[model samples]
Target: MMAISVTQHAHLLASRALGWLHTHRERGALPPGCTAELAEPDTVYKPLGETGLAASLVLREAVAGSTELRLARELLDFGWKQLGGGSMLHERLLRYPMMSDPLETYAHYARCGYRHEPLELLLRHTTSLHSTRAAEVLPNRRLAVANAARISGFDRGEDGDEGPRTGSTGGTDWAGLTAATWLGALPEPWLIDWLTAYSMTHTVFHITDWGRLPERLPDDIVRHVGRWLPVWIDIWAEIGEWDLVAELLIVDNCLPEPLGDAAVWERLAGIQHEDGLMPRDGHPVTGDDQERFAAHHHSTVVAAVAGTLAVSRTLGTR
Candidate 1:
């Protein structure tokens, strides 16, 4: 078998790093400054993480208008059927804490094919994920209503658990960040469908609860979330997923403004070693620095530099 290219190797390493992060989180072994909680056994699983949410928000902001609205409607129709009919894990999905943009939500629902029955069922199922009555109830209810209104308006026939139609159940099976990018790729008509599917799986579990989590979250939720984070990040970076690229850029941009620090840029720049390799760990170096000039010539380092530059330029443009 042909050896993996330097770029591929870098991505592999990055995936490992992300896996480590996820493992640490799931095990409740995060060092500090990170917060995630476990899921409740009785509750459903949703995959919405901060990174995913941020990416979604950015996508929504970047592509807004009638084209997107129409796409959202189409997606909502498909997503509701897939989710509520039990083809997808609807119950385990976590609802967004804050109400999603109303227009976006409506667009998503309009595209989802399920009518009031499944929509209502999804709302109820999602609502039950919360351990406490007061915790996520209101937000869930609101989302349910918003989603219902959107789908209800578009429902043209009897609504029930319609299984996947013939030749309708095949597509790429990208998980984590890879899946996120696919959603980002959809045109306006399909965006909501992708988002609806995404929201169900993009949750970030809190490893520890500081009086904020529901009364009964499963112990493994945090670990699972942490284990998946690094992999997702690596996939996002490797695939040139501009959604995540924009998110990182936004974060880097915001960091400097709030802290009055240019060091953040310098730090990111510094990660490039003199040889061009971007090691998963070790000291930070720049691609052009002389102290490690020889290092820049290495193929692996060069590939890393390319990835770093890609990320940097994306951020710079934003």
Candidate 2:
């Protein structure tokens, strides 16, 4: 049989995966737990919380301007409708947590040209969290907040100094965060477990634009991550950590140049079901529809986003 190129297969997988998501949207799709709560015909409610919604929206942006733009648009519409008063986005804003997800979600939508009053409110809401809740924000989340601010065209001060203050407390120290998060104290990338490693990767991606803008990451940190990325990818892929592997694919793309690991891409593409569900990890779960969807949705969403991004990069070079 003739082999399909990684880009072509990615396109195929993305198309099929998105189709599966759409087909199953009301059934087993939309995170099984949220299906009932999210069944409201007019809006997409993320019962699982902002992360799934964030990933779905990011997937939309990844596929934007491509042949899959229809799916992208559909998701955008669903998400936009959910931003009204008392919606998931709104509720998250009122709580005033230090998490950066709501900011990143809106920023991704903004990058796709869907700006509106509610999104701005969300951004403003996140900006406020910098000062009002500085102590609660962790280093990785601080990077997310900064990136969201950058992408949304909101100034986060020299280091979010403009945020509200709590007496003697200060804002998130951007320089200090950079100094502490990567390399200097953390274990080698290969030695770290998956989730923490993912956070570190996220720190790099947010700060450095996935290596596209290396200046975002210090020279030492960039060199460090770039040097060890291959080993990380090999290790994760061998263990069938499809989600991490796909994320590593993104990390590879953010490098100074594409890493061009067609084999790794193909291995990721190979494991995808014909219907396009990529299991979150090596072990496949079997059960009721909701149970199964909950187990696999995040990884499937990551695959779609990753595939779309890989295709975009491949085409950009060609």
Candidate 3:
């Protein structure tokens, strides 16, 4: 293998990671006749959405090279098709109007120019209902809905500069919803367990629209994250929790002024398989095709997101 600077390491990491996702896109497929009414959406639907989320961010940042870009678009297509071309989302909303996953999943595709008119209309109407707001959900899930809603024209954006990304009007206060999240509180640092760490990273992800708008983050929140995120990154990296490490790395690049830790980036690149898989931990990744995909697909998506943001932020700074 050729030598690489840390920035180049990030570039290659992104392309390779996304390449793996495109090749294994089928691994995330739902079973035949799957529907929104299914009891466990996580087994397949959630993975598809997460994959789309990574691919959409790659397109949105316009940071990936031509190969990565093509793969990203293909990944989006696969996700949309897997959802029965948005019919699943519409049916999902019909089944459980209060559910946010469909809207959240649809927004990932919409931001990248994938559209489903029926889903959009229903999302607009359903999200506006008083019950949607009244739905008892975790605060971070609420933030996810707010971000997705804004992206899909169901609500206005955080900047308030533009109306909805589409034609819809009136929505949640992005600022208020964010404040309700765990990270928004900036509570005692020692209180952050592994789960809270994931929550904090996601809060960063949703608030910044996966790093497209770092300016949307408040100064206090930024400072709070900046002050403590390094410690968390170091702790996770030490434990071989490569999945969480990659997420914290993405959070780093999302900051108004990123740490741009070259050592960590290089370390991540070194550990990634030649085919672009990033193991979830230091253990050898093993399984049948399906088991491996199920076990560590998330870490790989996170690695892709991390590397993509790292490159984009560096170029943006320059």
lDDT (tens digit, per residue) of candidate 1 on 170-282: 22121222223322233232233323323322221110011112122233433332343344434445543433322232322222121112322234334433322334334
* TM-score, model 1 to reference: 0.24
* Candidate maximizing lDDT: 3
Ranking by TM-score: 3, 2, 1
Candidates' C-alpha lDDT: 0.28, 0.60, 0.84
Q: Ten consecutive residues with minimal summed lDDT in candidate 3?
A: 161-170
Candidate whose TM-score is highest: 3
- Reference-based TM-score of each model: 0.24, 0.75, 0.93
Could you tell me the C-alpha RMSD of candidate 3 in Å?
Answer: 2.7
User: What's each prediction's clash count?
Assistant: 44, 2, 0
Residue pairs in candidate 3 whose N, alpha carbon or C atoms collide under 3 angstroms: none
The list of candidate 1 runs beyond 4 A from truth reads: 1-51, 61-87, 91-121, 128-257, 272-318
Better of 1 and 3 by lDDT: 3
